[model samples]
Target: MRRLLGRRDFRTIFIALTVSMLAESVLVLALGVWVKDLTGSDGLAGATFLALSAPMLVAPLAGWVVDRIPRRAIFVALNVVTAGLLLPLLTVRHAADLWIVYTVAVGYGLSYIVLGATVSALVPELVPADLLPDANSALQTVKQALRLLGPLIGAGLFSLLGGAKLALACAVCFLVAGVMGTLLRSGRQAVRMPTTSDRPTWSSEVSAGLRHLVREPALRTVAVCSALSMIGLGVGESLYFAYVDQGLGRDAAFLGILVSAQGVGGVAGGVASALVVRRLGEVGAVAVGIGLFALGSLALVQPALWLALPASVLIGMGLPVSMVGTNTLLQRRTPAHLLGRAATALDALVSGPQALAIGLGAVLVGVVDYRLLFGAIGVAMAFVGGTLWFARRVAQPAVSTEPAPAQADFPG
Candidate 1:
């Protein structure tokens, strides 16, 4: 971990991402709470996630753009633009202005896809292959750790001040992060121009990431399993608001506390991720995370605060552990030129289901018992995790080979 920090470029990127993520974490909870307060509808509040994730359906375009531009430039531009984009939230004065909130959510989603693809592509250029796990772990750890304070600070500011003030604070964080982007000295790549013969058709360019994932055994396995787990996760996204209000008998702000608990668990998971990856391999680590998340989900069925807090912790822990494993595997396996598209393709695969599920959960939370949803989520995740674990063991040899297309770039 110290080794990654010791590098000037990694340090700059790390700090930039940290500042940016702090802004996101602050907004994540506050946005839902703000919408809920305005409309008094759990469905609308949950739909904010739908708004945010809806842009992921266009991830291929975002990926193409990321790959075309210099990643560092894209990184800087995205933060600056996102800061400006968020300013419209200042205009959302009443329920009639909910459009402003949803619009901003869509903008946030677009920026998230572009910026995430840019960062995923840039990281491998900045670090050694062997340190990918540690680097990813460090990044994940800090992002999760900030949830502990970011949500609290967001909640406090929202309750004491207002959502507009909270929005302004987040904009400042993004601006500061953009400034930090200028400090990065590595992971800058020249614009990629395809040779005439190799010029990609629109469909080919857009689908490149998905094609790569399909061709790689391990990547495909992990991605499919991860997407399956998101089914429950998406359901939980909406259900949690109801859980806080009806089940736990708390107000909207209390949702921040549950998120903060998850952050605590995320911190521990991030710290331990590299160790888990080393012991279990990336696939095995992902399986472990899914199983842990399943346990956490099942625990939520009882609806007690005592159970909820620990369940949030387990959910938090599982996220980083699984994410670190997934990301490291992607970075290690993919070629540099394709990283942008591949990352976004993976995002589309996972987030698409999650976004859909959020909508379903929003509706389901009203008619169905939240406990039933939680139990179903837990069981589904447990089954996916077990399937992934079994597949990893049986398909060990096949997983070792790189995709056929990747070989040209990585010729021995």
Candidate 2:
């Protein structure tokens, strides 16, 4: 961890990523609260998440774009463009302007996909392959830590100022992130520069990520499980507002407490992730994470503050554990050239179902009991964990064809 922090480029990229994620976290929470305040409907609040996540369905194309350009340029340009796009949200004043908010959410989601792929592709260039797990964990830790403050600040700001002001503030944060990204200094030799000659057609480029993901057994298994886990996540997203309003008898600002509690779990999970991976291997760790998350969601079925608070913490811990393990697995198995597309492929798979699930849950929340919704989510995640366990018996270790450079301290 100390050695990874010593690298200048890693530090720059980490700071940029942290700042951008902090702002994004705040913006997402704020948007949810804003929509709920305007409409007083759980379904509408969930719709905001649906719009934010729906663009992930196009992540393969976004991934191809990430690979096609110089990553540093992609990183800088995305933040700058996202900031400009968010500026239009300042004019959103009434229910009629909600369409603009949803539009911006889609744009935000698309940029997130592209920038996320760029980050994955850029990490190997910035740090030694051996340090990948620790580096990835550190980034997750920082992002999670910010959750403690981001949600509280966002909710408070939204209450104090309006949504328009919050949107402007989030836009400024993106501008700062863009400036920070430009400070990163990865050498051309370290980065796999995309060539124009013999470039595949657009469709081929889009499918390239999917084919590569399908070819790797471990990667494929993890991607499937993660997608399943995301369905459970969507259930929670739709019902969270109702849970806070009815279960906890609180206003939007109280989301800060739940988010901060989750951050506590995230910190522990991030710190313990490498050790977990070392002991259980990536596949086993993912199963454990899914199980833990399922247990946490089941806990949420109880409406008491004591149970819900701890449940949030459990959820926080479980999610990061799953994500870190899966991410390390992908980085370890994927070739350098395919990293961007592979990351996006996984993104699309995981987030696509989640987006749809959010919409479904949103509708369900209006008609069904929130407790029943949570129970169904918990059962689904447990089933996925069981499926992974059963499949583990039949799954063979993938043959290692990685170049020698990637073999060093690879976490596979």
Q: Given candidate 1, what's the lDDT at residue 93? A: 86
- Candidate 2 lDDT over 257-374, as tens digits, reads 8877888998888887777766776777688789888988899888888898889888888877888778877877777667889999898788778878887888998999899888
Give the whole-model CA lDDT for all candidates, comma-separated: 0.85, 0.80
Judging by lDDT against the true structure, name the best candidate. 1
Which portions of model 2 miss their true places by more than 4 Å? 32-48, 90-102, 159-165, 187-200, 236-260, 298-307, 359-380, 386-412
- What RMSD, rounded to one decimal, does every model reach? 5.2, 4.8
Compute each candidate's TM-score over C-alphas: 0.84, 0.81
Q: Locate the minimum summed-lDDT window of 10 residues in model 1.
A: 400-409
lDDT over C-alpha atoms for residue 372 of model 1: 92
